[model samples]
Target: MRTRDTRSVARAMPWFLLVAVVLFALNLRGPIVAIAPVIGQIRDDLGLSAATAGLLTSLPVLCFALATPLAAALIARAGPERAVLISLAGILVGTLIRAQGGFAVAVIGTLVIGIAITVGNVVVPVVVRRDFPASRVGIVTGVYTATLNVGAMLTSLCTAPLAEWLGWRAAITAWAVLLVAAIIIWGQAAGWRRSVLGERVTAPDSSEAPPAHSASYRSLTAWLLMLAFGGQAFSYYGITTWLPTILHEVQGLDDKSAGASSSVFQVLAVVGALGVPVLANRWRPGSVVGLVGTLWLAMPLGLLLAPELWPLWSVVGGAAQGGGITIVFIIIVRMSTSNDQARGMSAFVQGGGYLLASTGPSIVGAVHEASGGWTAPLIVVTASVLVLLIFGITASARVESRHP
Candidate 1:
């Protein structure tokens, strides 16, 4: 009797799996990036405060923390295929509601999208590990990271005018249509279920899956990773919400120029996100983490001390920080012995990390209100980066898993 050719089956799954992963990634950051593009219109139309606008922008990351842990549990209950499909549908529906206008509705819609994206964020790694077991995990993560960047870049660039032409509500809501397209494509792929264990009703066994390591949350490495991830998120969100306004006010740029400049920062981030993981995979973990951390420290201070040098500094700094974040994600996968631990560790790190992240933009805004200038907030941001550097270095050292 002829034996089954597992190699051919493994090869066939990856091509389609890459497509599905990319679709899922394309929807991941639309909600976050889409808001900043048209935030002013939404604020003016609804008469919301600057602080409220910042809150609206940062709320999704806040929700990400709340919803991420549930992903592992939910996927266990609903199965990966259905879990992701439902999550995408949730994101689509949320985007539709946000387009309907009314500040409360928009916030509510964004919260829903936050929940959906969190699910996707949690599951994609697990799926990559399961679907491409033979491939290098870092490469799979690098592609995932790269596509997510492309998604964010597209939405950030497109959101503003689309809102202006079609009405802010319509432009914001239209992202739902993209989600709908993803859901349809993903559903079609569901029929090829026989190639795997049919979504095994439990998290993938992370113990023997990825490279192994010990993890104890109390370990300095764990604390450092958590702090580094949190600090990065906090700094990133703060930059995203305020950068345009800061440039317009401090640098005398017009509204259009300011927005355009801020968009450049995110565009640079795509390069960072795509580049960091690949490099981390190629180097000694300590050096890769340290170099990325140094960039993180320098970027915020560059924005603070040298406003005149922003065009060059911001792009380089933003890319470094973005790349640092991608490295963090890659480390989570690499440090874990199995997929289940990776997901669980990701949940622990991000849940705590984003809670730390949530404080960043809010505090910066408060500092801005107090000092009546960007100076204080910038100082706060610099200090945050230093903390990030400290933790990032600590985390880069060998660590222990929080799970069995």
Candidate 2:
């Protein structure tokens, strides 16, 4: 009876872990993206300049860049599970601080939230690599990536309505409920604590040996991944921060309509995030990267040339951006030889990439303010897509050479 019970428990573990991953991912984007739709109100209420408002979005990403490397060290000391729990605590605290209703408080809260999220950004890929079979990496990545976008979509769609009904402060605070639920479920989940402690952990099915700790940081492949990820983040965050405003100012949509349009981008992104990985699993990610890059370019160009087709452009851009992010994470895991190396690569990619990305929103805002239009700002995004294409091709080639 004891042996049978143990076997049954073992069978159920993966599902529990999957649930935990999904819940965790759902918290990753909602809090940040929720601010985008209501940013005009936030700026007006706080008496912020465009640059300062841009900083509101860019600050957390800056934190993601600066603090991601610390995640590996935290994991080393506290184990992944405990480190994640600590991150949740930080999220909880940040949400509460933001809810208190002052611009200074909100900025400080966002910084804290960014620091918390940085840990999850670097650690989740390692968890997937450690827990799942090698063959399942793409699917698992797709699922989590999809879940992450779902959270963003919900925020984009709901934040305006929520703010209208509950006020922005309450709406921002509402996200904390999701985080709290995730924390509760994570604590009760079976096998999570053991897995974190590095005892009785399930080994991946692949035959490769563990990589030396220094290998990922020193390799050319890691640098390529960082650049690819950086390019993607730059484009994604820039669009996300300003898409609603761009629609409102340039495309002549109302604030509500613009917010809804932004949600459409996020909704389509979910499709891309889920679909890209499955396609990449069958085809070469390198080839897919070029296609995705073209889609990213088309979005801004469509907006520039034909603002009338904003809906179509939004969907295409969202899909491409979503797919680009998912593919980069997939490559990060596939290119590494072990979970530790994967963690290291994730840190490097997100740390360096996000630091590079931190400039996107502020730069876009400054350019918009200076040039007095959206054209120049969007051209910047187009350039970023081109960069994404260049590095993505090289990153995919590196993965093919290493894995094949």
Candidate 3:
């Protein structure tokens, strides 16, 4: 029999697992993002008002929060691998249903996809924690995170023209290709694992879990970590939504150029996401939190003080946002002693975080409307960074204590 360390090493970099994770990630965000590019088309064709049409996009985000407990429960029963297959299937079915036409069908399909994504969001981190050794968790999780962004970027960039050519229904459903690929590959990997490892594949044992995180919602650590995660989500959504307008209005850039500048934030987030693992390997978790926190702070402050340097702020903030999410997951998985604990902790953190996230755009927009400038909104974002730092460092300190 292999010793624990050898077992850890053998499972650390399995090619099939890596590919499956990549595929899973590639499909995860594309479906949701597909709507953003062709939203007006859907609106005009369906004869719906702006808010109703927005439901196709915004409802999924709400589902991410409201349906999280159910997602956690599914993971608790189905096991991670099977839960993944279920998620992909849900996404595929939902996509097809969405493409069937009619506003009611589209809304239902979007809700299904959102709920399915909530399952993936909760489980994949648990999967990474289970399959990878401690040394590689950060990197693998970063890859997963980065691939999600890639999925959104690819579809966001492509879907508009596809909608023009094929019509919104076909174009929106076109991303089903990703879901198909992910499902098949992950399915094969599942069977292959059963053959080689003879794994029983059942729910994680939570009997030994410490009380602090056993009922994760009641855990102080979980609440603080939730706040940290919320800060990351709030700041990310707010900036991603408004950055282009900020650049255009403040920098006097044209729509295309301002949009291009905003892409700097989205694009560099991959770098930031991938970079977190490298930093995690070298630095203390607390130190990593501090670095990302500073970067997060710099974006909002720099934009406020030196609006002309929007490009610079966008780049740094993009990386910070990527790292922000990656590090938060690292802490969540690191703090868990079992898959059950991981599921519970992740549900609390992510559910609460996304709930706050769903409000970000509206709140920021309201603040901008009330104040009649970006300064107040930026100030609000800066406050969110402080929340991230204080709570992230606090949670990361607990991670060190748990693992050290």
Candidate 4:
């Protein structure tokens, strides 16, 4: 009877763990994406300039780049589960701070929020690699990535309506409640006492020890991965930050329609995130990168040539950018031989990638200001997609990581 009960508990653990991870991913993007749809209101209310407003969106990506290196150390000291709780606390605090409604206060809060999300960004891949079977990595990654898109989509779609109903301050603050729930669920499922005690949580295969030095940092393959990841971030953030404004100003959509259109991008992104990995399993993943790159390039060109077909362009762009990120992440995980290596590679990819990507929104905004239209900015996006294609091809070529 005792043995049977123990087996039962063990069998149930993975499902619980999966749910927790999905919920955690859901919380990751909502706070940030919530701002994009209502950014016009924020600028008007706070009396911000275009550059400053661009900075508001770009600041968090900067934090992600700067703070990611520290994540592995935090995980080493506190363990992954505990580190996640700390991240949630930071998110909670940052959300409250941002809700205060001043420009400086919001920037500070966004920085904090970026740092917190960076921790999860580094650690979650480690957790997935550690906990799941090698064959299932793609599927599991898809699940979490899809959940992330779902969160982004919901926040983008709802923020305008929520602000109308309850005001923007309340709309932003409402997401903090998700952090609280995540904390509770993570603590309950992971066991707070065990995590707090600094008990080492080993993978099922205990012989795979942490690497002494991450050789991936020295390898050309890893650099290619970083470039690929950075390109995706550049496209995704650049487009996400500006898409609503473009639709409203350039495409002649109303504010609500523009916001809804932005949500359409994310909704299609969910499809791309979930479906791309499965496709990769069947095809040579490297070949798919070219196709994805073409899709990304077409977005800017489509917007430039045919603003009337924004809906079609948005879906194609969303699918490409969304699937591109997921593919890069899967590549990072596959390149690692163990969880520790995965953590290190994840840090490098996101740290450098985000650092590189942090410039996108600001540069696009600056170009838009200089050129006095969206054409120049869209051309810049097209150029970035070309760079993405170049690096992505090399990154996806299945070269063995030196560290692995």
lDDT of each: 0.74, 0.82, 0.87, 0.81
The list of candidate 4 runs beyond 4 A from truth reads 37-50, 192-213, 247-250, 398-404
TM-score of each: 0.87, 0.90, 0.94, 0.89
Name model 3 segments beyond 4 Å from true. Answer: 1-13, 199-212
Which is the leading candidate under lDDT? 3
**Residue runs of model 1 more than 4 Å from their true location after superposition:** 1-9, 44-55, 133-135, 196-220, 399-404
Q: What residue pairs are clashing in model 2?
A: none
Residue-pair clashes per candidate, as listed? 9, 0, 0, 0
In candidate 3, which residue pairs get closer than 3 Å at backbone N, Cα or C atoms, i.e. clash? none
Model 3's C-alpha root-mean-square deviation from the true structure amounts to 2.9
List runs of model 2 lying over 4 Å from the truth.
37-54, 164-166, 190-199, 202-215, 369-372
Error of 4 at 319 (Å): 1.0
Q: After the best TM-score superposition of candidate 4, give how far the Cα of residue 316 lies from its true spot, in angstroms.
A: 1.1
**Could you give the candidate ranking by TM-score, starting with the highest?**
3, 2, 4, 1
The superposed Cα distance between candidate 4 and the true structure at residue 352, in angstroms, equals 1.0
Clashes of 2: 0
Select the stronger candidate by TM-score from 1 and 3. 3
Give the range of the ten consecutive residues with the poorest summed lDDT in model 3.
Answer: 199-208
Model 3 lDDT per residue over 1-404, tens place: 55675466446437679899999998888898888888888888889998788788778888888999999999877888899999999999999999797999998899999999999999998888777788889999999999888888898899989988999899998888888989999998887666555544443354545555579877888998999999999999888888888888888899989888766888888998999999998998899999999999999999999999888898899999999999999888888888778888999999999999888878898999999999999999999888899999998887788788
Q: Candidate 2 has what TM-score?
A: 0.90
